[model samples]
Structure formats: C-alpha cells, structure tokens
Target: MAATPNIYGILAEFETPADAMHAAEKVRDTGFRKWDVFTPYPVHGMDKAMGLKNSKVGWFSFIGGVTGYTSGMVMIWWMNAVDYPIPIGGKPMFSPFGAFPPCYELTILLGAFGALFGMLFMNRLPRLHHPLLKHRRFALATHDRYFIVIETTDPKYSENETRKLLESVGSKRIELVEE
Candidate 1:
C-alpha cells in the first residue's frame, strides 16, 4: 500500500472554552503559528489569547469607498460637463451637489463589498480540504465542544512532542489529524 502525503494537524479537545483559552494562551506565548481554535460560540478574550491583531479589512473598505466616490464624481463630471454635455431639467451642468446622495450610497456599497471580499480572500475561507476534516471528533465544533488545532508545518512540530505539548496544556483529548 502507498502512503498518503499527510497534511499534518493536531487537534486538542477541551472541556470548556476557558480551558481552551488558557491552552491557547500558552501556545500563543510559545510563538506557535498555523493554529486555530474552534468553539460553539465566540469566547471573550480568545482573540487576545490567540494573538490576533486588528483587522485591516476596514482599510480596504475605505479605499474602495474612496474609489467608488471618485468614480461616481468623475462619471458625473464627464457626462455633465465634458462628454455629450447636457442640461438636466434646466439644472446646472456638472452639478456635483446633486450627485452627493447616489455617490455616497455607492461609496458605502463598494466599501461593504470590499470589506467582505477582502476578509474572505485574506483568510482563505471556505477551506474544503483541511486535514482536520479527517478527524471524526471535529464535528462537535458546531455543537458544544471546543478545540485547538496546530498545523505540522511549524518547525517545532513532531509527533510525540506535539502530543506531549497538548497534554502539557491539559487537553483532555488529543488527535493527530492527517489529510
């Protein structure tokens, strides 16, 4: 039989999100990357334990909002003043003041789209092929269970050592999930 190329991951189960959080803090302080926690609900202080930084999704949204506003203004400017110039119901040509509402709405639309898409793209979401999928116990994530997983790509990972590490942090159940 041929051996499957493994996508190595470690799953550590905890009885409570609090325990999971403590373990997460220990792991994060160890400077481990490529790790994630799964919980039935959001755990307060979990982000800090996971060492997450402020998201830059808003920055992307801001840029998109600016772009959309500029685009709207430029389009209005070109249509009213330069390209095929026409008066609107005896209104002034190139009436930028009249374009404010639609331009602002479009700015908001673009900003929301940019934020949503930017987060999904940056996080590489919809991960359908994760190694953790192979773990039978992971299904409890959506229920009342809590888990922490670390990828084997980390330089410090080893089979026995990884198991020992999770155990040291008081993980009740430890699994080496492979893809």
Candidate 2:
C-alpha cells in the first residue's frame, strides 16, 4: 500500500503574544475559518483578533433554569393539590407562594448544571487526545510560547500557501503537525 498521509495542520509559533495576535488577525482577514490560537497566558485582544463571537453558554443556562423552575412548580402543584390534596395547618392545598422558594432553588441548581455542562460540551472537553499534544514543541504552549494552527480542514487551507501566510505574518517557526 502507499504511505499513509498523516498531516493534521500547520502550526505557527510566534515569539510574543503580540505576534500571535497579529497572526490571528491576518488569518482571520485571509478568510480562514477553522483555525485556533494557543498562548501561555490569555492575550487581551486575541478574541477580537480571531473574530470570535460571544459564546452561547448563557442561553443553555437560561433554558435549564426555566425548565427547572417550571418543573418544580408543576411538581408542587400536582403533589399538593391534584394528586394528594393534603391541607396542613389551615393552609391551602397548593400555595403558589410557597412553591416559589423550591422553584427558585431548583432553578439555580439546574442553571448551574447547564452552565457547567454547556461549557464542557461547547469546548469539547474531557478530550483524551489531540494531534497538537503529540507535537514535540507544542508543550511550550503551557509555559512560554504562543501558537496558531491553521487546520488542514479549513476550506482555504493549502499547505504551501499556509506556510507562506504564516511566514508573512512574522511567524519565526512553522511546523507541519501530523495527525
């Protein structure tokens, strides 16, 4: 059989956050969509440079909160009034007012769950492996280096053109990361 192709992407290393940020902006402007930047620390303008939009995790939390509140209210009403109708201490079988506290608690509970799970799912967490993890020099991402990866999967990706683009953006080191 022919040799298997193992290319994953082009990984560009920059000497500083500013270089990475500038490279990100150039990548974004060049219409390459499926790329990412990794830095040892959060870079202030990286999100803007990458043209990333705000995350939708809050929407997931909101939906979970609403569902939890509605479910709590309905459960209370059903158990106290419709199902058992137990009157206690001259109180009404189902007091909408009394249900508010539990509903609020459940709302908070599920909202927390939603936010946690939403973030995990959105970020594709619990990942066991990534191609970048195998790159010999990529470990510096957690310490002192910044990286920009132009994925081969991106629509505009061309190996030679991407290498040239990375060089044009002042990347001092560029490597072809393999899957």
Candidate 3:
C-alpha cells in the first residue's frame, strides 16, 4: 500500500471570532507553538490569546536609520573636509547643520526600507503559494469564517489529541491539511 501523503497541519473551522479566539487561547494554553488563527476581520485581544509578543520591526527600523544617518554624516564630512577641501569665507568644512537635511532624509528613507523588508522577512512572504490557499474551505476565511490551524510540525501536535482539543473548543469542522 502507498504511504499516506505528508500532512501540513490540522485545520479547524470556527463560526465566529469569539469561537476562534477561545480556541486560540486553548491552543496557547496547550503550548502548541506552530499554530495561527484567521478571521475575516481583526479581532481585539487575539494577539494576547495567541500569546504573541510585541514585534521587533521597530528595532530593524532603528538600526537602519542609525546606519543611514551615520553614513550620511560620514559622506558629507569626507566630501567637504577630506576629498576636496576648499576654505571659503573661513567656514568650517563639515557642519552638522549643513548635513542635517540630507542625513534626516536618508534616515527616513532607510527606516522605511527596513520596515518593509523586516515585515516581509518576519512573515516569510513573497511566497507564490501556500497549502492552505489550496484548501477548498479556507477561502471562506476571507468571507465570513474563522479558522485555527495547528501545524503537524508543532512538537505538541498529536493527531488524535489535537483533533480532540479542537473539537472540545467548539470547532465546527476539523480536517487534516495535506502538504
């Protein structure tokens, strides 16, 4: 007999955001790390229910802004003081005031880039497809449904136990999603 196909995860459909939020809380309490909740609209407190922490994207933007500002200052200092120094009206070759505008512009530019790239990296985005996207019922998630998916790769995942947990949390339908 052919072996069963690899499973991506267990998908549990829920009828309401409250139901999905409660399911997420239960799953979080169960200590399953590789799981997510989906809903048609943003649900307040879902992040707390999912046990998520504050995002690190701000750090990325801060680092990028610092780098940009430093580079801008260094470039201005080098160009004015070292590359082709010309004493004009006894003015300083490099002035922070003179560099401030360009440095600020660069900081904003690089900070925006950092936020964009960090979000993409953190989300693992630019993907052409996902197995969940192919699941027939998953399309309803954008319309009027809520979903909770626990990945098979999660250390706490056990087919029978996970299914039971989801059922206990009031999932309307439960199915295994194949990889």
lDDT on C-alpha atoms for all candidate structures: 0.87, 0.94, 0.94
- Can you write out model 3's per-residue Cα lDDT over 29-73, one digit (the tens) per residue? 999999999898899999999999999999889998998999999
Off by over 4 Å in 1: 1-5
Would you give me the overall lDDT of model 3?
0.94
RMSD of 3: 1.3
Q: Which pairs of residues collide in model 2?
A: none
Off by over 4 Å in 3: 1-3, 86-89
Query: What would the TM-score be for candidate 3 when compared with the true structure?
Result: 0.95
My TM-score estimates for the predictions, one after another, are 0.92, 0.94, 0.95
Off by over 4 Å in 2: 1-4
RMSD of each: 1.7, 1.5, 1.3
- The residue-by-residue lDDT of candidate 1 on 1-179, one tens digit each, is 88876867889999888899999998898788888999989999999999999888888899989988999999888877888877669888877798888899889999998999889888888676866766788989989889999888887777788788889999989987876
